[model samples]
Target: MGESAKTEETAALSVRALDDETWPAFARLVEANNGVWGGCWCVGFHVKLGKGRTAAENRAEKEQRVHEGRTHAALVFSDDECLGWCQFGSPEELPEVKSRRLYEKGLVTLPDWRITCFFTGKGLRGRGVANAALGGALAKIARLGGGTVEGYPEETDDRKVSGSFLHTGPMVAFENHGFTRTRPISPHRWVVTRTVAPA
Candidate 1:
């Protein structure tokens, strides 16, 4: 590709806050990906899953949260196509996480923001979309009065992990954005933290 064309491709990817206005695109992306992680709708972090709730119910709840302004995410887009998203919100807004048992063992305090989930569209995984999404989430958090932000990401340096298992994102992604390793919550997962200044 020519220099300008390469630049254009890079410029084409944008990050937008997930809100009512962007819900349709998010929905489309999720639906296209089989509702994401077995029809999770990315709501697994916000509430306990598998309470006999169907995927349709989960979808409704997610849509309700979006409409009520109760959910937050950074949606990555290429043109009008929603490529993926990074889910972040306050602790109360997202109470559940992987390895909670171990995470609570060292919980001295709650963070202002928690990055709980991530999803990259099929065929778009290794293209820096998740990094963009993480950057976008931090920027949005800063604008909303930033504070200590935490993430639960898996360390992938030692072994190969499927993208399907990395809902909270990879550890290097958080480290790249300046998050420090706080503690190990699971075998290959950790609790990472970063403090962002208010914009």
Candidate 2:
């Protein structure tokens, strides 16, 4: 999406696309969190990590992808600081995913957009940053020619889950955004889908 496109905003925050202009803010938030999940830089779904691949390499590669416009996310900002982000892209752009074996076993067709991961600032947990980021992602997808969108979120009604393990977000969050539970991909995780009309 272009910079001129309309941004998704809330009373306390605004959402912007993760691009050249927003890269630094994104980096700052990630850096503050020790590169986010052991230096993942939120690039886990974009590329295969491990086997001596350093966090530094992931950071550099993520930056490179951002520069090349190969990455997509809805970055939430509270004033000038980035609070967090929700990563979204085509299946090809984000090939790696959670519960891959089960996910593929039930996969019928690829979605036009896939909502993979989310990250919120350390102190900003329990706030609506992730929800805002999700709204922002849907808005961005709408502007980018909307279609079928999918997300794998865990059900949290029956038990308590650590926030760190909720990178895909909660079932209530996606449901709040009008996504329907398409099918269960795991014991707790479900594949949710929604259709966003183009803006």
* TM-score, every prediction: 0.95, 0.93
Off by over 4 Å in 1: 1-8
The 10-residue segment of model 1 with minimum total lDDT is 1-10
Residue-wise C-alpha lDDT for candidate 2, range 1-199, written one tens digit per residue: 3333324334678899999999999999999999998889989999888878888999999999999999999999989999999999999999998888989999999999999999998988755788899999999999999999999998987798988778998899899999999989888999999999999
In model 2, the runs with Cα more than 4 Å from the true position are 1-10
lDDT of each: 0.91, 0.91
Candidate 1 global CA lDDT score = 0.91
Whole-model alpha-carbon lDDT for candidate 2: 0.91
Span of 10 residues, lowest total lDDT, candidate 2: 1-10
CA error at residue 168 for candidate 1, angstroms: 0.7
Error of 2 at 52 (Å): 1.3
**Candidate achieving the largest TM-score:** 1
